[model samples]
Target: MTYSGVVKVGGPADVHELTDLMISKVAVGPMHNNAYLLRCRATDEQLLIDAASEPRTLLNLIGESGVASVVTTHQHADHWGALAEIVDATGARTYAGRLDAEGIPVPTDVLVDDGDTITVGRVELTARHLVGHTPGSIALVYDDPHGHPHVFTGDCLFPGGVGNTHDDPEAFARLIDDVETKLFAQLPDETWVYPGHGNDTSLGAERPQLPEWRRRGW
Candidate 1:
């Protein structure tokens, strides 16, 4: 199969192939949260992002590749609902933002602070601490040497705007500011954004809407 070609399970809408770094995408649960299975082609080692929901399904998808670690993007239950089960089944280490570690149901083996490096086989993912949607919301940055950078943004960012701040002005400001300087300002337009609960987007697409998003305050 080609790198960009998708493998349909039940349907292409449920699962797909990223075609880079052998990343696999799964959209599961009632909320349709996205979970990614990242495989390091160099070593065949794997890492899971979000764990999201559907323990049985996730475990089945993981199969025997063996996950090196499960990175919880944030403390939200929807994101980590099956985290404990996956960890128990695979013995994969757990990682989370230090500030949100206590809130995660499973014990986080590694406290990922901003700029901290998390390894998956030969690949290294840098943690970008983005506070707002939650006090310790984080986005993982994976700069693939073969292509453009890929950022796994939990709920802190999305295609059109920033995550919901519950109408809190301060939280909104903080999230937007950090996103701009830390993510948007630093990464190039080709950077891919793998968000928490929906389809993927690009920094180039989102960059132009920063002003509009700020004005709307969503």
Candidate 2:
């Protein structure tokens, strides 16, 4: 019943309060990226998603937030670079899809794929395989009473455009199809989108721009 790379954060969500989402944006400002911590009040479990940049600083943030489980959307360094440090600092289990396994400095303890869910303290994150930008990329869905589900989109899908697929000749095209089918089709028009490298946005906000994206043709 025990797992590796998984540990406890001292702060409990109820005392910390989960209703507020208790999200602290680490490595923001000059770094200007997001590493979100979702604290569940009922169970006092914290889920850390994506290690933005600056591992030590991120750990400090994690300690402050009380994270329990950490999951990454992709294996790319920018996304996966801090895996070792964060894992070491907090002993939080690292989850990544099988395809992106090679990119992790140390192998991920939990291998997640499409439709699989990782339940931390009080949050349940469903995984969706979305390949294109990195041959192996995925998105995590966080469902709440809020208007729409929250998606952690790595380098795959952004606000206006998806991630660049420079390594793969057909990466851009595949990502377009991924956005249209896997993401947009299944998710509600108003689902919130948390991308790997930009400000927060939502599906409804990006709806109008889909046509423009299609026209640009990757």
**Which predicted model would earn the best lDDT?**
1
- Cα deviation of 47, candidate 2, in Å: 1.6
RMSD of each: 2.6, 7.3
Q: How high a TM-score does candidate 2 get?
A: 0.83
Which portions of model 1 show Cα errors greater than 4 Å? Answer: 1-20
Give the clash count for model 1.
0
lDDT of 2 by residue, 4-47 (tens): 11122232211212253544444332335556666665666777
Q: TM-score of every model?
A: 0.92, 0.83
Instruction: Give candidate 1's error at residue 160 in angstroms.
Output: 0.6
lDDT of 2 at 147: 41
Error of 2 at 157 (Å): 1.5
lDDT of 1 by residue, 99-213 (tens): 9999998999999899999988878889999988999888999887777888999899887899989999889999999999999999999998888877788899899999998
